[model samples]
Target chain A: MNWDAIFTSLRLASLTSLILLVLSLPLAAWLAFSRWRWRFLIESVVALPLVLPPTVLGFYILTAMGSRSPLGRWYADLIGSPLPFTFEGLVFASVIYSLPFAVQPMASSFAAVDRNLVEVSWTLGISRLATFFRLILPSAKNGVVTALVLTFAHTIGEFGVVLMVGGNIEGVTRTVSIDIYDQVQDLNYAAASRTSLVLLLFSFIVLAVVYSLNRNSPLWPTLRKR
Target chain B: MADAEKTMTNGARPLQVSIKRNFAGRFLLDVSFNVGAGPGTVLVIFGPSGSGKTTVLRCLAGLESVDEGTIRFDGEAWSDTAGKVFVIPQKRNIGYVPQDYALFPHLSVRGNVEYGIPRARREAEGPWIDRLLLILGLTDLQQALPGSISGGQRQRVALARALARRPRLLLLDEPLSALDAPTRSVLRFELRRQLKQLDVPAVLVTHDWEDALGLGDQMIVLSGGRLLQSGSPLDILTKPENLAVASVVGVETVVPGRRVRRERGIAQVQVAGLNLWAADIDQPGDEVYVCIRAENVTLEIGSATKSSARNHLPGVLLGVVAAGPLMRVKVDVGFHVDALVTRQAVEDLDLKVGSPVGISIKATAIHLIPR
Candidate 1:
């Protein structure tokens, strides 16, 4: 059943989601609260992944991470390896591919926080940065969870970016989606269906968890009585 | 600029503000005033909606910037557009309570109160936090989240949160506007008492006249984003400087009149073909507006009783409306005049629409502003 590919996919999705979460926190905060005149330009760029085809994004990312580029050369010098075709390259591509999934929910929720709460915090002698941590982050708990879940699931289901950036290496870069394609190409219908069923079930459960967290009522009705 | 520096040296008042800011869509805010020098002083900015009262308070708190002028608090310039100095709100050391109270829904009452204290000093500030909760009568509900508390309780939590910082100044924007009517009245006196006990200099913005009169030691009337008048609360209520100030301060009856004659510090003015006597002013103009507050008017049935009031006009009752504890009785005696009488008085006098009524207004009760 290609358990090696399954484990690799799990590792890549976990690392990619974690990296996206850390990078998206400050980026989403700036997008939500900044009054800069050119802020819409940044917002448009962040939202580009939502509309752009994965192959188009992967093409740019692959070109940028090639050994000839400055970023590629610097990373190769530091890590003694070129970026493309490695598991690290796959993680980087997934982060950019799923950027909107992590950022949109968080930015919208942060923007929805009562403006008065933030101003009151400032008036109470809390700095803006402190207020972001103390007040805003806690208020946006549901959105943060949604962002993590969506990013993790999106990274798992990704195909085009992963294949373009990280070539099909059985244990290193062949994720569940890539493994499914490899199985079908080899006319191994039984293996492909098993993997497809797992992906479908996983996606469904992730969505159910997100919707339940965001519902107005508590997920367990009995707990609300107290 | 020279004059601003001169006032800075005096330092008699604790807060001084003179700012001009232009907003989009033709709204221009230009105001200048100084609050009292003493602690426990409360200066209220009173106006109707869209009058820039909240904007003025926001400017004072450093939440909103001004296009011109300076804001001086306790001899330090908080905002000076000319000098290019603008202190952020965190460094301003000010407590601010917004209209809605804005309690953190996720935090308990105690958590909200303790939010302003630095984490390093939170342990040292524990006793103070307890005292604040006790003083505000929130000790019993210290662990209750804001969403579970009543409106009045939420307000106290917001106050506690702001006060925990031990700020030099307090800014409240329509502090009581969010509560229901009954809760608002009960909290009004309680808020006044708390402010006095705390002895903090505060600036409050409110559209409600009752809030201004009940809480302020000094009042500034604002309308159309301009400072119309500044004086004691009673003075601004009884004697507004112009028609705009008169309307903003809720003077119920204002009619244009011409001064016919002056005698013994009393001027006889003809308003709506009715001769009215008002306290005389030597403004050298005949045209004036006769402004009379509804509360200052007394309504009588049948023959007028003997009183010091100089103007008594026989009229027909036009309408009766309930206004809190009072009944607002409108009468027409050549011109419409409003009088606020107790509900019991309404029943005793059997006042009803289309009934004969008499309105007696004192000479001093009538204010005259040159048209």
Candidate 2:
């Protein structure tokens, strides 16, 4: 097994899901509750990655982070290095690619909460920010967990975006999906099959955990009975 | 106007609201009323389901904004469209119990009640919260979740949570409408007693007239998003200001009449070509509507001569319907007049359909509103 590729994927997925969690909480809240006139435009922009081809999204992101672009130039000025073909660039691309996975579930769950509970919180002299933390976050716990898990798994399975922006650097940006493609290119069928099996087993376990968390029945019903 | 000046000079700040809100294709809510400040002062916004009673309560709580006019509570401008002054609901310091009670499902009853207190003040305010729970009878269920409690218990938890914060004003929207009939009737008195003991001025909204009469010190009748009348509950029940108010107050007999002459303190009005005497008013209009409650009309078997009632009309009884403990007798005396009497009275008078009877109404019992 390609252990270095596995560890890099874990690091990138963990960091990307953490950043998305912090960013998506308030964004999803605003999407669920704001009464702004043009809110659908923002919603569409956030959901663009869900339907668009990953290569197309990667191409735009690549163009935006090229040496000639303003963001690319500002980052190089600050960190004394370019943004393309690095682990940081891969993290950035994966975050954009998996944003809809993080936001949609959280927003829907927040919207499903009884609005009177929120209004009652405000009437009790609790500020909106405090109410969000005290009432809304706890109430939407399952959706929040779902968002984190999906974002992590989606980032781990990303292939096209990482290859486009981060390139095939061995330890820097070569994640498990890119390692599988490299093994197949080299005619190493045994290594490729082994990696694919691990991925399939890991995805099944992740989904099992998600479904169990969402179920109303206890996961270990026999133990519960005892 | 004189009463307004009197309330203002006593150093008490009454809640004064005058607002106009448009719900696009729904209706235009235009109302203005005042709630006196003191313990045991409850102002009920009484109306039917679609009559914008909740809208008025929401505007008062700052949950819903008004499109025009102002809402001033305790001399502070909570909302003023012309001046662009609006206080958000968080800063309003209000205790609001919504229609469903809206207990926090994720928290224990104690946690729900302790939610409004600041984290730094929780330790200090623990005793106060305990007192609130004891008063509302939620002490035994403090550790239970809202879902595990009964409906009445959940309502008490909601009330305890609202009162824990010691808000400046309390707002309740159909507080007892979600319970069963038996529970609702029992909670009606319990809620009124709690509000009086808490000594906080409240604004309550309800479609049920019994809630309005049993719980309110002052009542405002609303219909079709318009303010029909504002007065004491007894005053509004006995003397509504207009036809709409009469209908909302459930006054059963309202007939159009024309004033024929005025003598001393009484006016002789002709209704269905029959003369009826009412207390005189100074209004110049001759056209009016005479309103009477069914309970105020007395039925006689024959021509009764020993009573002091001013108007007596002899007609045939049209219908007799059993209504709870009383019998509703309808008599066609020029116009149909309804009288509510006990079944024993009905049996003693031998009241049957197509039988001759005399209906007597006191001059003071007849209320006149301009047509």
**Highest-TM-score candidate:** 1
**DockQ, every prediction:** 0.79, 0.70
Q: Please, what are the lDDT tens digits per residue for candidate 1 over residues B1-371?
A: 23334433554345789999899859999999876534666888999999998999999999999999999987899999989999999999999999899898889899999988878998999998999899899999999999898889888998888899888888888889889898999999999999888877788999888999999877889899988888788888888888889888889999999999999999999998989999988799999999999999999888999999999999999999999878999999999999999999999999878999999999999999999
Query: Model 1, residue B362: displacement in angstroms?
Result: 2.8
For all candidates in order, state the fraction of native interface contacts they contain: 0.93, 0.95
TM-score of every prediction relative to native: 0.92, 0.86
> Which pairs in model 2 have colliding backbones?
none
* Model 1 segments more than 4 A misplaced: A209-226, B1-13, B260-265, B343-352
Residue-pair clashes per candidate, as listed? Answer: 0, 0
Q: Taking the tens digit of each residue's C-alpha lDDT, what string does model 2 give over B203-307?
A: 899988789988997788999998888878888888888788899889999999999999998999999999999987778999999998999999987667788
In the range A127-149, model 1's lDDT, one tens digit per residue, is 88999999999988777887898
Pairs with steric clashes in candidate 1: none
Q: Which stretches of candidate 2 lie over 4 Å from their true place?
A: A184-190, A217-226, B1-12, B258-270, B273-286, B295-334, B337-365
Per-candidate RMSD, Å: 3.9, 4.7
| Ten contiguous residues minimizing lDDT sum, candidate 1 chain B | B1-10
Residue B62: error of model 2 in Å? 2.1
